[model samples]
Target: MPVGFWVFPWDIEDEGIDRFAARLDELGVTSASPSVLYHSGRALLPRAREHKVRLLGGPGANYPFESLETPLAGMESASAPGTGKRFWQGLAEARSDRGIRLNAWAMPMHGSELGRRLSVAVVRNCFGNPYSYALCPSHPQARRFAESLVGELARSRIFHAIQLESVGYLGYRHFHHHEAEYVGHGPLEELFLSLCFCDACMAGARREGISVVELRESISRDLERRWRDDVWSVGVEDVREALAANDDLQAFISYRQATVASLVSSLAELCHSESTELHCFSAIFPPTLEHSTWIEGTDFAAWSRVLDRLIVFGYTAGGPGAAKVDEGWTRSELEYAGRYFDPSRVNVVLNLAPQYLATLDDARRRFRTISEMGFNDLSITNYGMTSETRLDWVPELGRVLDAPASST
Candidate 1:
């Protein structure tokens, strides 16, 4: 695997460009992706190039929930993506000279904390109201909004690929506390319920004569009456089977996948017209593991057939169980991911920050395992930590990423 770092650390803003380059050079890193701040600073572009590191497009640090597929000026309100066309143009030219590729990563799911703080809705939870800023695949407006955003980004010369991450709604159904009586009413009640009983949504369902309203009402009543009963204890098995048995729901998911595919495909066609590359980032939910029922509907495997590359964030494998039981947990996860997609077109993001950096020995083990996975490209969680802080292994982790994999 070509190991890489997600270099947008919160602390790097004040650190001078020279200091930053020296740090990467010391770590033996060949390339790094710029953060939103990096793009704004013209001085850092040449410095990164001089260091001979490939720089992917930085993520726009604006409202996370703003549909990248929408036409709202609100989506462009973020600083860099808002007025960074000139920055992108500069980046494109610089990358051409330096041989780096620019890829824009956008979060289409829940909006940023800023969006939540401002939204009137009270969809409260640990991760914020799931409704306020998430892009519900069931909504046409949400889909169109995403499509338009892609079109706008496609016009840029600097960004060659687009990384759509965390695009789907809340995962891990167990975490969805309000699913019982809430039905479609989440924190973003207006947006979430905006089209729940909408004419278009209802009409489409009516075409199948499925009566979505009746089904929803039925479930809502059941949930409300048994709200106190342990749905998990009572319904988990049935819910799982219900999710599996509904071929019709699965078909609906396929249709939604086709809708997303069409939007991305259209954007790709737009990019190809300009001779730019378009790609999508997705994750493979381990079959044995529990995932949100909605994920099966996202139909990403079908999506891979149409998009350029599928970047699987294989962090789940490096999770709690393996870490506690086996030192080689990360490697096993990467290998498992390889089974789903061709290695050449897949980019597995290695978790090298925060969670992985719990201890130096565990960190070293994670790195070694990732290296052996033979991934085409690699990325860390983020560049938020400093050498003095929680990251005692930054130098070692960086060295591991920069070094050639033993197998390679």
Candidate 2:
């Protein structure tokens, strides 16, 4: 199996490139996914050298290159504080020295400053409340900005592959700073409330022959009733019933899927044109859990058509304090995703922190299971959170990964 590590710029700077590369070599890691266009922080190190430095807060691009002028003007771009070495340049040097593949980790639509600056371009719910965490995919300016950013990353020719995150719609709930208390909301209700009724979204729904006016009114009335009752009904069937009852709602969901698919397709074409591969971090929809696509507008089947690889975050085991471990959850999620994506191209990401895995023995068990399933690609959650104690498990995992496929 080809093992990869997800690293932050802070990790590289805190631990010099030589030390970082040495650690990766020790762990048998073959690739590194470093965050480049990160959210709300820029690398402050002069060069990508060893130093203990914290990332400064604020929304801006951290790439070494200047922001390409686009139709949407005034996009912010910030270079690293010291040596002003672009992030890609630093990673390129490490790649050359360590002989490791470099994959650029990018967050496309989760720009806090951009969303707040252009509130109209942010995602608005049925109640006309804007979510500052997400830029509405249907917004023309937001779409153009995302497309332009992806094009720039692909054209850079520094990354072996661009791993895209947050490329779809965000729902009503977010882990924002100083989040307020909004109780009595069910998951299904949250999904309903998260439906975007912005002008662009409404226009798309309208074009799909959905009666946006009627759908908005219906959703508003339903939400009011749920809020007054202070009760939420669970299960996917409840969502199915609601959609089945409302033709316009069903049409709108379909429209959202098509819109997201089109955007990804366009970006994938651009990546292919540059001879760069495009991959996306996708949420695994367990059969028992709420289907995330309902609110996020991610159609895995559609995305598989354009994406080169589908990286599923299949962390079946819970963190340190988890009530119980469900060993079957990971396999189930992977199998479910296998229906839509090629098993060979599906990279399963495992949680490496003690909070997620109880012990090295537990980690070994998970690795054996993945190998038994014939998965050839695996990745750790991140390098920043891998504690000194957990670091010991890396080489052990490498041993299991090197073993031949199990017949079981």
lDDT tens readout by residue for model 1, 249-318: 4444444355455556665676677666655555323322333223423445555556676665545544
> Residue 236's C-alpha lDDT in candidate 2?
70
User: Which one is best on lDDT?
Assistant: 2
Candidate 2 global lDDT: 0.73
Off by over 4 Å in 1: 7-13, 16-71, 74-99, 112-130, 170-204, 207-211, 233-239, 244-248, 283-296, 316-322, 325-340, 385-408
lDDT of 1: 0.46
TM-score of each: 0.66, 0.89
The lDDT values for all models are 0.46, 0.73
Q: What is the lDDT of residue 3 in candidate 2?
A: 86
lDDT of 1 at 343: 64
